[model samples]
Target: MNRSNASRGGVAVLVLAGGEGRRLGGGKPLRRVGKRTLLDHAIERGQQWSDTVAVAAKSADQVGNCDLPVLIDQPGIGGPLAGLASARLLDCPLVLTIPCDMPFLPDDLMARLTAVLGNEGASLASSGGRIHPVCGLWRRESLMQLPAYFATGRRSIMGFAEVIGYATVGWDDHWFVNVNTPIDLAQAERRID
Candidate 1:
């Protein structure tokens, strides 16, 4: 089936690339892993499940040039929460958020989350005793609570996810050791090959 048809049931992928990446130098998305940039790899992973893919960025320059639409972070909010809020307005019924740097996320990740999503606020991926809210499949409408969530002086992905109610499916921690520093990037390079 064409990639478009795979997600015609109303699912879209939103690659969250808005972080400043101060720890790994700037331009985290542009960081190279193997023969591809982290953004490119994340986009490819999105394409594996949906044709409708977008990048949620802090600014246009953050993502540079890309064919997909770039949803800038909401006016007064930042971080992954802002990315989710920007995507909340999407026409699709569901949106899967994936960090640009988790290159080893399981191929069945969305499927796993969707299977347990039910009527909850969102379904997230967990590993090593912690939930990775950035790697979640959210009901688009559930994100409408963003404004309310932000009012409490909170701006964390996990905090908002809990406020809205969420379920998690655990995975091996190895698949989620995200790149955050020069040393981590070097380790990712070795793993990629």
Candidate 2:
């Protein structure tokens, strides 16, 4: 939703568009499925549920037509953790971290994510026995523990999740499919279209 018309509970939207996508020949964020680029799809999806939505891009040019703030990954591509660290600096309490590649994320994703936030920190969406770490909702306060986790050279998102604790919310697995390669994009396009 538009931030101007959004309700209470300030939620920040962080779209992970900084990956090099070595498997997809780089600049995957700009790759098109039909009419819109993958990054555009993600920004639109993110904007639907939050007042503020920003793209985490390696370079300003990569995000192209997106009007939202484009945040560069700190240390320049240390992975999703770096993206989360950058996202935490935003002026909102809750942050919705989504990947630009996952164009078909459920429309109710933000609602579902925020609905399950508790004393533990945040909630992650799990489907078909796999946890979608990138499709997570976290509190900005929880990010204080991340710098140490990154310093320890612990890169796995799941590993970090275990330390902080999270609740798993299940949904249809197909909805969380992320396009990592050209083949994956083809498959997702067919499914989503």
Candidate 3:
């Protein structure tokens, strides 16, 4: 049986690791933040929300040694949306999406997103008027709406969120800082220390 499909209920965590991370000199998931790689940190956080956590990557080779299932980006689609598209296949009603680089993503992410999920297809995280659509809880049934949305040739994550009528939960901006550069990694290291 597929590891991702082993769980039939409760929220599943999908850690997005498919980005090329060119800005960080590549191999972003393998980059170290203290003792663990960025991907390791991400998986650790995801485990806080669910035992059925998976990583979404550009390829298995990119993900390296992750014990969790790696959902490769959909053939024709790329980026976080592709990961989400693939994650929807997991045997869970709700999927919580997190990024590989954001080590400090709010611990209460699931709590906040679930509070607003209500009747909408999604509940995204926003901070200081900026939306972090990738770090959100998604409805698997609603994710079935992707093929039709992509049919229009529009790939913006926010665009699909809008099409599905999403709700937003606010957080302090510092909680969403992602490691995308050497300096950003240094900052994360400092934050960890």
Candidate 4:
């Protein structure tokens, strides 16, 4: 795919791995999926979708030895919005954000998001009648609205998207499985096998 021709100049993929993962016992991105870590799987998916891929992590310690550039979230704030804020520093005109815990992320994620994004300049993935706000394509310029949103004590990605006016692209629910707990990991393992 030629990302350069994307509506917003070029697209950069941002894999959000800054979560504390308390429910999954911590270090969720490092958890193994088959032979590779979840972070590795997310990075692989990011690379497949764009030439420039970055990981938004809380710290280098959390990310381990990832080869791609890493962006640290602004201190004190949490959630995927912080990751998006960090990624806004990148030179690309658009960014596609995905959570590190989603191993079976669709191969056509960018294509589908871009298709619906159209003039709204932002679009998020929806499955099974639920919105997955982190899995989104956004104009880098739109990130300017974040600091004010954060200042107002709002950190929900869906809230931010709604305030900015975004489109939602629907996909099959099975393709959006996320590993948030040990049982989810086991189910993902079975699906992988």
Candidate 5:
């Protein structure tokens, strides 16, 4: 589906591409796995689950060729929370956050998370007993609490989730492998091949 058809279900997909990619020598979103950039792969997956897909990057230049709406993270606050905070600008009631570097993110991620979201306001993805805090679905109301959280100088996505209370949807560990370094990009290339 195209961007015009997205967010029809009251959910918006936010792709977080603001990381410095220090381990991968920077510009991780531009790194290619075959003919496509990691950001391209992420946008593709995001479009599959939501009609209103957007990118949360430090700047529009960081998103490369993807033409989705860009949400610039608030300066001075780092990590996924910044991206989550940027999402508050969206009109949707629910927001799904996905990291750009995870090329193999699950197709059913939104379905599983939304199914269990219930009345608690949020749901996060978990694999092999490890929670992927960035891969979460949050209520817009819950996100309003973030600015205060950032004010306290804390930026833990998991900590924010714990305070809001969230459900966990377990997935296969292999699916969430992220491309944080050159080696990971190479490995992702192999998987794509």
Candidate 6:
């Protein structure tokens, strides 16, 4: 892991806590993983990648006391796309989108993703042949294409990646394991041990 690149570029990280977390009984980001909430872990880890870490939550009220700036989803609650756009609008060179529910994300994620910077719009981290779209890094410039993509009403991140052609960066599957259900949280708890 390249600790040296911990703070790279004028990058900003957007922890997408705007999801309803319907699969995990709601407030998943605030769920405890060990001694810390998932949102706490997300923000703590996010601080390593960028000095300007912000959160995109469903409502500002959901993350009121967070150390970072919290932006509410625009009137529509447009999912990760809106979060990504909000982060980009900060005008940073790169903005990494991480799902708040993914507490065990690799610490070196931003370094690994930005390692292939000059590739297409962005390169998603892939493990075991599955693309972790929300666990990926994107350039602020990529937002230029998002508006047009949103116009099509297809909000899938993979769909947008396909339209823009992204490079693939490989990482260990454990590094990208997302905790969505109680079962997943239990499994991740064991993994951490």
Q: lDDT of all the models against the reference?
A: 0.90, 0.82, 0.89, 0.89, 0.89, 0.78
lDDT of 4 at 170: 91
TM-score winner between 2 and 6, please give it: 2
Worst 10 residues of 1 by lDDT: 1-10
Residue 48's C-alpha lDDT in candidate 6?
77
Which residue pairs come into collision in candidate 1? none
lDDT of 4: 0.89
Candidate 1 local lDDT, 1-193, one digit each (tens) = 7765855458889999999999999889999999998999999999888878999999999888888999998888877888899887678889999999898889989889999998998999999898999999998888888888888889988888888788899998998979899999999999999
Per-residue C-alpha lDDT of model 3 across residues 1-193, encoded as one tens digit per residue:
5665344248899999999999999999999999999999999999877878899888998889788998888887877888888887788889999999999998889888999999999999999999999998999899999999999998888888999989999999999998999999999998888
Q: List, residue by residue over 70-182, the lDDT tens digit for candidate 6.
A: 87766652677767667656658778888888777887788778887675787788889888878777877876787788788787878877877777788877777787888
Best by TM-score: 1
Query: Candidate 6: misplaced stretches above 4 Å?
Result: 1-9
Tell me the spans in candidate 3 whose CA falls farther than 4 Å from its real position. 1-9
The runs of at least 3 residues in candidate 5 whose Cα sits more than 4 Å from the true structure, single-residue gaps closed, are 1-8
RMSD (Cα, Å) of model 3: 3.4
Give residue 55's lDDT in candidate 3 (0 to 100).
90
Question: Model 2, poorest ten-residue lDDT window?
Answer: 1-10
Give lDDT tens digits, candidate 5, residues 1-193: 6655643568999999999899999998888998899999888998888778999999888877668899998988788888998999998999999999999998889989999999976999999999998999999999999877777778888888987899999999999998999999999999999
How good is model 4 by TM-score? 0.94
Worst 10-residue lDDT window for candidate 5 reads: 1-10
- For model 6, state the Cα shift of residue 157 in Å: 1.3
**Residue 131 lDDT (model 3):** 95
